[model samples]
Target: MSFLKEISEYKDTIINRLLSDQELCKAVYYADEGFLEKPDIDDLDNLIYENIFPHRFIPDTTETAKTFVTISCTDYRPTGNSFKNGLLNIYMFTHRDLFRTDYGYTRMDFIMTKIEELMNSKRGIGLGELGFGGLNEYVVNEKFQGYVLSYRPVDFNR
Candidate 1:
């Protein structure tokens, strides 16, 4: 398979894993404040689904509050003539107010942990097992704060 196809399939896999977890979905709904207006369960699901992006998050001026995730690849290169290696990055963004609670632990901590559980060591079509790389803080537009989790293919020989 082509690299693009592999990436696309992997993205879909990630989305499916995330959406299938009820606990994670509930946390995401609360973090996004979906309960404030008493939205339907379908609405919550739609909101969560819409927030996830394949490559990048297109900024929207009309959105006053948002939480989202972006899946991207970096350092892509051919290895040993037939294999490919790269890093897959998952970025989670949310408003600063929802980023951390007063007790020092952040609200996103559970979300990130859940994602790690779902993705780490997972294998995708045309790719090797994903190994956890690292996690770090990331800020966007002075209003959003979150974490970026990186993963690398274990063998890159698929």
Candidate 2:
């Protein structure tokens, strides 16, 4: 497959895995408003699905609150013959207040853990199993405080 196809497929896999987890969905919903009752599962799923971006996060001025993820292939290289390796960066963003709020430790914590559980070591099209590298704090504009989780192919020889 072409490199573009590989990256696209990898991103789709990540988004699908995230949306499939009910607990993660609930955590996202509660992240903004801890006191609000849970909404329907489908609604939560839609909310997450809509927020996930493939290569970029286009901030909407109309949005008063935002929580989202942006998936990007930041680096890639061919190992020789047909083999390849790359680094994938997944950025999880939430409102600064929501991220810092103490709702039994905050929902960003749960979201990050769930993302790691779903994505780490997962295989993708034209790529080896994903090995989580590390996570670092990322500031997305003034309203958002986020983390960037890095992943790379585990076995480059494949």
Candidate 3:
């Protein structure tokens, strides 16, 4: 199969195998990585879940197209016992045809340690829901390269 088709196939396989909420979230989290050492695959799966199925999830397909990933981070610490929420920064590079993706979230909430570690990491793409306030929401200032990623969220509902 072609590259995009293979990813789509993995997506379907993940959706099929992780039929429960908890299982689904965990599967999605790891699948987001989508690459692993062959012999080490089982070990990685075991580290995440108490089973072997996770090892078979990633497709070690070769890449023919150039690609880059966007880095994202949460805006704050977890509050109360509810699901944690945070803002993410997205970047852009000019391509003749740029594409936007939903990133279909896993309903997978991250603990403070996980959140901090992931946010600090230089690689790996994060998957999360679009927070309730929508893009019409507010954004505080922070530095990015030489420019600031400042923006006023637009409320499409308004």
* Number of clashes recorded per candidate: 0, 0, 6
Model 1 Cα lDDT, one tens digit per residue, 83-153: 77678888887776666544345657867988898889877633566788899987776777778998876
* Deviation of model 1 at 88, angstroms: 0.9
Model 1: how far is 111 from its true place, Å?
1.2
The pairs that clash in candidate 1 are none
| Candidate 2 lDDT over residue span 96-149, tens digit each | 767654456655676788899888877763456678878998787888777888
The estimated TM-scores of all candidates read 0.78, 0.81, 0.21
TM-score of 1: 0.78
Show model 1 residue runs off by greater than 4 Å: 32-40, 43-45, 61-63, 100-104, 125-128, 154-158
Pick out the ten consecutive residues of candidate 1 with the lowest summed lDDT: 32-41
lDDT values for all models = 0.69, 0.70, 0.25
Task: Name the candidate that leads on TM-score.
Answer: 2
Give all candidate RMSDs, comma-separated. 3.6, 3.1, 17.9
Judge candidate 2 at residue 79 and give its lDDT. 71
Best by lDDT: 2
Per-residue lDDT for 1-158 in model 3, tens only?
33122223332333232332333223323333222111223233333332222222222213211111122233433434533334443221111111212233211212111222223322222223222222221112121111112111111110
Error of 2 at 100 (Å): 4.8
Off by over 4 Å in 2: 30-37, 43-45, 61-63, 100-103, 125-128, 154-158
